[model samples]
Target chain A: MESTQATNHVSYLQHKPHKIGILNWILSTDHKRIGLLYLYSIMVFFIVAAFLGLLMRIEKFAPGETIMDAQTYNGVFTVHGIIMIFIIVIPGLAAVFGNFFLPILIGAKDVAFPKLNLFSWYIYIAGAILALISQFASGGAPDTGWTFYVPYSADSSTNVIWALTAAFILGFSSILTGLNFIVTIHRLRAPGMSWFRMPLFPWSIYATSWIQVLATPIVGITLLMVIAERTLNIGFFDPALGGDPILFQHLFWIYSHPAVYIMILPAMGVVTEIFPTFSQKPIFGYSAIALSSVAIAAVGYFVWGHHMFTTGISYWSRWFFSFLTFIVAVPSAIKVFNWISTMYGGSIDLKPPLLWAIGFIFLFMIGGLTGLVLGALATNVHVHDTTFVVAHFHYIIFGGMGFAFFAGLHYWFPKMFGKMYNIKLANISFIITFIGFNVLYFPLFIIGLQGMPRRYFDYFPEYQYGHVISTIGAFILIIGIFIMLFNFFRGARKGEIAPANPWKGVTLDWQIESPPTLLNFDEIPVITEKPYTFKKEEEA
Target chain B: MEDKKHHISSFNSLLMVLIGLFIMTGISVMITEIHFSTFSVGVALLLASIKGYLVLTYFMHLKYDEPIFRIMVFLILLLFAIVIGITFIDYLLR
Candidate 1:
């Protein structure tokens, strides 16, 4: 099983400089290149989706001077959510960074199945193409939003079938990637690396992978039913054929709610890695952080019904889900406590990565705590579909997950490309993105409390001011993201060569040289202690 | 390393799980004849669980993988249980 000393010979290792053909990039199976490919493609989709979001905000900026009509606004938000959830966030961190570094971090030459990883990318692209095609084929991208709840999803005038089918295809891709990562982690850890010794990012990805393999199929089947009922007139979810609409709500949320975890869990892992590296200390309660990941995944499953409390779920079940939802918060809080404890009395470096990690903790705390307010049966009934709910999720998803992602990208940019980012520009980008995100989303909490419902193209005149402020914030957020992107692009190509461990981290991935050779390591290293057991001499 | 060897040798267990899954699929389809509609779905899912268990233990080689992987598989079943249980409770109470 050990192929020690043999030169690593992955297929794309021999890629000549001038051989950068479209077919070469498309057909390649090299994990690093594939990861870069995913990074590029997902970023492209993110920009497109962000543009749609900006359009939505602009249309609503002044209570509708008529930039985009109501129907178009619906299409805009739906497409924005679809692209962001399906295209960028879900795949971006895991598929790009996970694929790039997990095997390398573990001292493996490649994932157990290289070909399957490439195929997953193809499936993702295919799903993306099908969804994009629907924009032109019918009325527009499905206006049902990403959740695509039953009656609306089943009966929407737009091309809902294509979107559902695309989602189903993407689910298979996600499941396969999950299965691959699970197998790789199980079978291919470097000789000395025990499960307990693995890095937190991989630990987080492991939890996310399990969620993906299990929950993804349910969504696959659920969406398949959506397509089936529409095409064959089955009564599985469509209300017209004796199918209960609430059943659709159940089936949809069963997957969609956990889907939120799928989006957040990996970012949690990324933040877990960053905290240790930048704080200049081993993570406090390492086992607790690792186990809490699993805890969140396990508890995440029971709480999907919280999303449906407003839609007339049974009172008993509502109470049960609401309780479980609150229970789920405990583990998340444990993670926050562990992170804060890691920073306590430690020689913390306020580097860009650490800044974002701290930012994530602050915003995620706000989000997770507010989530309890939403999970309570009484409180949710009032704010269920309002901007409060929207704001809460944005805090968690965008503020929590999005900021961590930025932190991770900056932290690893040097390692990924053997270059150093412009710290001044990175800091500026961070400030703009953070402030803009808060400005864009925080106002929603206030307006929502004042009775502003979400998903509306236009609103009351008084609300117009809030919407305008939010729209301006969205612009600032986009500019910040662009600046970050530009800095990274320039840094990667021309910046200073990164040392093997630029941040002086102790993870196995940092043990390897920057821009590692195709096989990651010449020899599979063994581990004996916790990953961040920093030597006392290095501390001083 | 120990887990990998065990998985490599569990070829028989994998086959057994496949056979069991197919059998459960047959039983689920056959149970449509039983007059109780809710009972049929329950039986079908029960069989499906057995099949799921078999696959988790054998094909996925979780039986030989570390305790954590096994814990993961169990966690998934627990989740499945909660979803089905709550949904049925609501369905019946209604």
Candidate 2:
């Protein structure tokens, strides 16, 4: 059945660039245009956030005597984290790539709710603008870290309420996107595309949208309480007002810890696509990998307590959280094993996307293992508030989410723009980014172990060397990212034209012509067999 | 064509959603008059859930479309209950 639609898609081949007008982009419902809108908007937000980090890094390059004062540095880092995570990275992979590709992958014309898809983009931008404006209006961005923990969050005099409200609105946008994806995947699959036969990327997205729809509201409500407490004096998390501040942490992490998966799962989806196409084989443990995506999403929700282990939570509660944390790791490990096994003895092609995929495996493993160390009650007491925790999260976010974003961009570059990115530049970019990222983040592990706390503007002189090394590494990493942007920009406008199946991928999207029609198909595809069955039907 | 047929039934669900919206707002305002501290909020929420459920079942077409969504919602609610319940347990035990 999948083959029927694949062959039937030959009739549709419309690729005239849609008017390329400002009004067309602003008001468009076409998923590709909307995706480009997201791509450009998120890139701008990332630049703003990245600049804030650079300013702070320069301040901390030495012993941090006085490039910026203490409160200013705190506010800089806070805004950096808030803008990058909330405004950019949170929606980075799924909203940009998943929105563009999922419907295409499933052989559908558009998302389930096309207008809602566009509305989500507008809401995301509105929230981002509001948060950015708060920086100027509210004396500076909130001094509270992105986590916005209570007591500090409850007591802080900065513009925390505006930031929290913006985050809540952003959560609403994410939830709507998730809901649209869920319904679209369920109802809009072309005639024969069964669950097993669908592309692995969309399957992972399917799992991710569930997390978005279900878990986002928890944070939504939590952030609202913070705003209410600040403005209305509602005391839900204020101890003085008969509320437990620690309860705020529980509520925050409940959404946040799963949010870690929210950041990484789509990356996992990208790797799932990359491994099969490059290795020239079906994914080993296809059902395991598919179900594991769902398993991570489900189990990911219960393990938030592990984040609060050192925060005066009860002993038994700590044990429960630790145990559940271990359980969540099993599915994550299963995915790793499956990817490695997929590459075992297969006719592997060493493409740029493949390099990033393999890089993700190596770095993501480091991040995941260290997470166990922190998940344990005894060890967490030592590392909970330190630079080690900061380092661990960067490895996961930078190494995990950041690497996956590049991999997906490269893997789908041809499909997205009907052109090939400079392979040489891509490989160079990956190498520099990988080395620079580790150089920047890895030392924080050592300094963090030696008792350096996170979110502090001033540090002990003993930590000066690590800080300098990290500062230098940040420059290298930024250069690598700059190379990526240049390569993609050049490729989109002037690179070699891409064929329909540039990588010889087996997914439904590649079965169609490059720069697929607005509707994606002249006829809906039907599926009769499993996806990526490269061995049984060898294609050399 | 299937697209046109699907459109007609889809409109029924949209109308049901609008009807649920009116019912929810009416129930919420009326409950303020009854005025029982926790109970009022609880009853209002219960009515809201019923409205949401009706919207889900009839409008979203969950009754016939797929079981995964219903199960997903049920699981989410179950987890919410567990988190709130366990927190309350610790409070009582202390």
Candidate 3:
């Protein structure tokens, strides 16, 4: 269905630059370059956070203050949470892969606004710098945690205001990127590419952009209010100053809850794309998988009140929120089931990407099921502030979204760089990461059920056994992470040359050169069929 | 896209909008001073909302923008209003 004109000569990497060296990359308006830039920067932050997490686990290995004091432990965990939530996962797949592939997947050359896309990276870097400064700028590292829950945040001697401001700026960065994607998706589809004809990855990005645009402002305003509370003595959240703390919780979760969707939706998009490609079948239910992302994004907003359940909200509000939270699982389950159905009776390749995708489904199911337990008013009371909540979120965010990120990276690595990493090493790393991840987190559930609290430097002797196992597991997980990073880094420099369509996928991105040129298409592709149809070869 | 001439409010109309906003603010303050204590918040919110509406419609040119932009904005407002309504349910019940 595609009609090609005279092709562009240069691949994107070979495209000439106006500036030399680092400036060429930094100033480049190519979405692919910017995507790689985001990938590199985000990986650095992820590594930092991972190391901090390892330290936390190390200190937890024996008992009280194994390596650091309580205050230091608190600060480390808080910074880890900030880096992971704000810097790594919030932007996550959509920022990295979405920027790289959204336009190409939809048969467009570039996002609607390339300048804004580059500006967003700069803004992200600026926000990262400001956030780093917040930790070291004042009395000490901010101990308020990433949520910046007030009273403590307001009263804390640390530079909470700077953290708040940094978060505010980062929110702007997120909003701009979201806005760019939304407009690009809306306005830049090539000729004859209808809404349903678009790939699921772009579809999920569309849904995610809406969440980023709509929900991020609430957190931005809330963080600013905390800044105001600290500086202007605004009595908004500090109970000592006649402010209601629950209100702060309300505002915080209002954005942060939906923010979870911002993290997971693009990852869900990745899984949807991977399922059809690896399974060698059209998706079992295209509309269901595509619309489920939107459905998840929509229902995700109303469930924020679930986070405040143990914080003494009223019975009716708590029950209402609990019910709403339960309702969200239906759409999530639909997507998960459809992914499995797509693989049924198909020629499954069992590639590393597909393995990670399957891994995501397993971990996300556990995460989502445990979420129901936390969503219930009765069980929430029992698990609140315990390692239970910590384990539950890690299962979802790290296990589900993190796994999906790896899957997308492996799936699209060839497309991004025109080379393939070692498949054997990739598979090995996935297995190790998966095994270590479960090992590290599973014991937390056991000990948490027995009443171990999270964010503590010390634990009872009874809990020490669990912590010891978990620390060992953490070491395994870190080794896996390092191996995975090493595999990618080594493969990028030296790997097999990948074909244009390595997976024999039917999406628009596969129709192009492996390392696509600076302008994606020579002649803008004219599309006529649904994105995932595998019937092109015989017909052509 | 930017070259498309959206409907622009005249200087006279913008001035009128500003004046209306000022009068609403003044009337809102007056109502609070006159001890409409129960409706004070309601009145202030109403007036502030009007000023916000005027600014958005004229200054931000939503009045001239496409239907999709209007729908996006209306949806955002609806989301906020729904959350506020839910909050009120808990507070009023308490």
User: Which candidate leads the pack in lDDT?
Assistant: 3
Among these predictions, the greatest TM-score belongs to: 3
True-structure lDDT of candidate 2:
0.84
Q: What share of the true interface contacts does candidate 2 keep?
A: 0.06
**Ten residues in sequence with the least summed lDDT for candidate 2 chain A:** A4-13
The local lDDT score (0 to 100) that residue A320 gets in candidate 2 is 81
- In candidate 2, stretches whose alpha carbon ends up further than 4 angstroms from where it belongs are A1-20, A535-540, B1-73, B90-94
Candidate with more favorable, higher TM-score: 1 or 2:
1
TM-score of chain A of each: 0.96, 0.96, 0.98
Better of 1 and 2 by DockQ: 1
Tens-digit lDDT track of model 3 for A393-489: 9999999999999999999999899889999999999999999999999999889989999888988899998999899999999999899989998
Ranking by TM-score: 3, 1, 2
Native-to-model Cα distance after best TM-score fit, residue A303 in candidate 3, in Å: 0.8
lDDT of 2 by residue, B1-94 (tens): 6664342357766786788789788978877788686465457667877887777677766776546768977877788778766554544443
Runs of candidate 3 exceeding 4 Å displacement? A1-8, B1-5, B23-41
What Cα-based lDDT does every candidate model obtain? 0.83, 0.84, 0.89
* Tens-digit per-residue lDDT, A31-111, candidate 1: 888888898888888889888888888887787656877887888888888888887877778898889888977778899
All DockQ scores: 0.48, 0.23, 0.54
